[model samples]
Structure formats: C-alpha cells, structure tokens
Target: DQQVKQNSPSLSVQEGRISILNCDYTNSMFDYFLWYKKYPAEGPTFLISISSIKDKNEDGRFTVFLNKSAKHLSLHIVPSQPGDSAVYFCAARPVGADGLTFGKGTHLIIQP
Candidate 1:
C-alpha cells in the first residue's frame, strides 16, 4: 500500500517566491518525517527531518512542519532560486520500523 503520497506531481515557483510541497500519510504508526532533494544522475540528499512529536523544524532555507492529527506534512522553501529546482521526496518511518516509506516525489521548478 502507498502509505505516503505527494499529491502534486510538480510545482512551479518564481524566483524569490515561496514554494510549498505537501505530503500525506495513511500510516498512523509513522513517527518520523524526512525530506530529500534529488537531482539528475545523483542520489537524493537529505534536506531536513522532523519527528512526529514535533510540529516544526527548520534548517536554514528549509523548514518541515508535521501535523500528527492530520497525518500531513509540508516543506516550505523561501526565496526559491534556480538552483533549488529538483525532485523532492517525502519519506516517513514507522515508530519501530527500520525502513522508510516514500512518496513519488514532486518536481519543483524555480523559474526566473
């Protein structure tokens, strides 16, 4: 079963604008949320992570918000730049699970 879902296949944002990527999960046992950015011909790089117990976590230009009640999460990128364009994947790990479930990923295009 697809426990995690990234509803938008792609998102476009103007340079210097804010881009929001959304994700939803059906597994209530998930206790961790992670966002990864992937570029062509390269492996995904960890962007940020948040625990299910927390509502928000930030690291520089990246921020992740979790809503346990809603079983949803989002990644917000401010002042999007051309270099920020990539496929973003949302992943979640269950409370006692070692593996993570991932979404299909949403391609973010930062337009000039």
Candidate 2:
C-alpha cells in the first residue's frame, strides 16, 4: 500500500523554540521523500527533500532526516516563528512515479 502516515494531527510550539514533526511509511518502494508546508487556502509548498540515498537534508531553518531502514522521517524547525504556523505534509514517491502520496497533514501552531 502507498500509505504515508503522520500520527499527530497537530502540534503547538512557542516562538523561538524548536518544532518537531514526525512521519512514517509502510511502502518499501518509496525512494524519494519530501516535506511541504501549506496555508489554509493555498496548496503545499515544497520545504525540504531527501533521496533514499541520503540520510538528511536541510534548508535554512528547516531540516529533514530520513531513516530508510525504519521507514520513518522527521522535520525539524529551529527557532520557530509565528510565520511558521501552518499545515505540514510529508510525501513520498517511488523512483518512477510522477506523483506523491501525502500524509493527512499536521497543523503546526507557533504561539507568540
């Protein structure tokens, strides 16, 4: 099954603290992973991605780590800000697929 799971439906963090979001997958064929941030009405925007060949990837304040053996991944946001409050979705695609399978979503709330 092409299922990506985000166990937590939401998270809250104080500004300037660290925010951590988790994801898990059951599909062994997924070789590429991505994290997207979304606002209420707009579509998700790509945040960070990691290939199966790599263990981690980072971009500015965002970082993603993948554990292929465990079929798990996480995204970390350092010095979280109110602007960072949004829905985060973890997605995965097999090597040849054109689309991604996304988790339901995790709403990140950054309290001022």
Candidate 3:
C-alpha cells in the first residue's frame, strides 16, 4: 500500500511554542519525503524535504526529520505563529516519480 498516515487530524499550539507533526508510511520503496503547508483556498507550498539517505533537513522556522528504519517522519515548526494556522500535509514518493502519496492532513492551529 502507498498510504502515508497522519494519525492526528489536528494539532494546536500557542504562539512562540514548538509545533510538531508526525507521519508514518508503510511503503519501504519511498525514498523521498516532503512536507507541504497550505492556507485556505490555496495549494500546498513545499516546506521541507529529506531524502531517505538523510535524516534531517531544515529551513528557516521549519525542520523535518526522517527515520528510515521506522518509516516515520516529523515536521517541527519553531516559535509558532497565528499565521501558521493551516493544514499541513506529509508526502512521500519513490525516487523517480516526483509524484507523491499524501496523508489526510493535519490542521495546525497556532493560538495567539
């Protein structure tokens, strides 16, 4: 199966705190992992990504960590802001497709 699972459909955090989102995949062939953030009525924007060969990747306020052995990955947002409130999707794909399998999504709320 190509399912990527985000068990929690939502998360809430206060501004200035850390926001962590978790995801799991059953497909061992997936070698590329990515996270995308979306605002209302807009397409998801790529946030961070890591290859199966790497364990971590970071960009500004975002960081992504992948554990190949467990087929798990996470996204961390530091100093969360109300502006960060939106849906986050975790995606993965095999090395060549460039196409992705996505989780249902997590609605992250950053409380002011």
Candidate 4:
C-alpha cells in the first residue's frame, strides 16, 4: 500500500495568487516531512521541510505545514508564478530512516 498519497492529481492557480497542495500519509513513524519541486526531465529539487516537532516551516515564497494528529501536510506557495509551475511532491521519513516515502505528486499550473 502507498504510504503517502496526493488525492488531487493537479491544481490550477492564477499568477500572483496563492497555491495550496495537500498530502496525506499512513505512517506515523515518519518524523520528518519534506516538499520537493520537480521540472520535467530534471530530478526533484529540495523545497521545504518540517520536523515532527514543528507544525510549520517556511522559506521565502514557500511554506510547509505538518499536522501529526491528522497525518496530513500541505504546501503553500504565495504569489504563485508561472516559473513556479511544476510537479510538487510530499515526502516523509523516519528520524533515522534512510529512504523517503513520496506522494504521487500534484501538478500545479500557474495561469497568467
């Protein structure tokens, strides 16, 4: 069974607006959560991360929220832009785990 899942296959947003992407996981052992942005053909690049102890983490225009009780997390992009258009994936790992569990990913389109 998939440990992490992205219920929405895609999302659309107007440029300069806010974009929200959500993910859910089944593993409570996951103590670290991360978001990765990917462009076609290129490998996913690190975006943001949140520790299990924290409910939120932010970087520049990107923010990540974690809700351990709900086993859920979300990524927020403020002032979404065309350049920010990409596949966003949610991933999680245990405190000492080597590999990460990733959601299928949500395709985001920033409409001009």
State every prediction's TM-score relative to the real structure.
0.98, 0.96, 0.95, 0.97
lDDT, each prediction: 0.95, 0.95, 0.93, 0.95
lDDT by residue (17-79, candidate 4, tens digit) is 999999999988999999999999999999999999999998999999888899999999998
- Kindly indicate the candidate among 2 and 4 with the higher TM-score: 4
lDDT of 1 at 53: 76
> In model 1, what lDDT does residue 71 have?
92
Clashing pairs in 1: none
Ranking of predictions according to TM-score = 1, 4, 2, 3
Q: Clash pairs of candidate 4?
A: none
Off by over 4 Å in 4: none
lDDT of 3: 0.93
lDDT: worst 10-residue window of model 2: 1-10
Per-residue lDDT of model 3, residues 1-112, tens digit only: 5379999999999999999999999988899999999999999998888989899998999999999888999999998999899999999997677679999999999988
Whose TM-score is greatest here? 1
Candidate 3 stretches with Cα past 4 Å from truth are none
What's the lDDT for candidate 2?
0.95
> What order do candidates take by lDDT, descending?
1, 2, 4, 3
- Window of ten residues with lowest summed lDDT in model 4: 88-97
Q: Who is ahead in lDDT, 1 or 3?
A: 1
Off by over 4 Å in 1: none
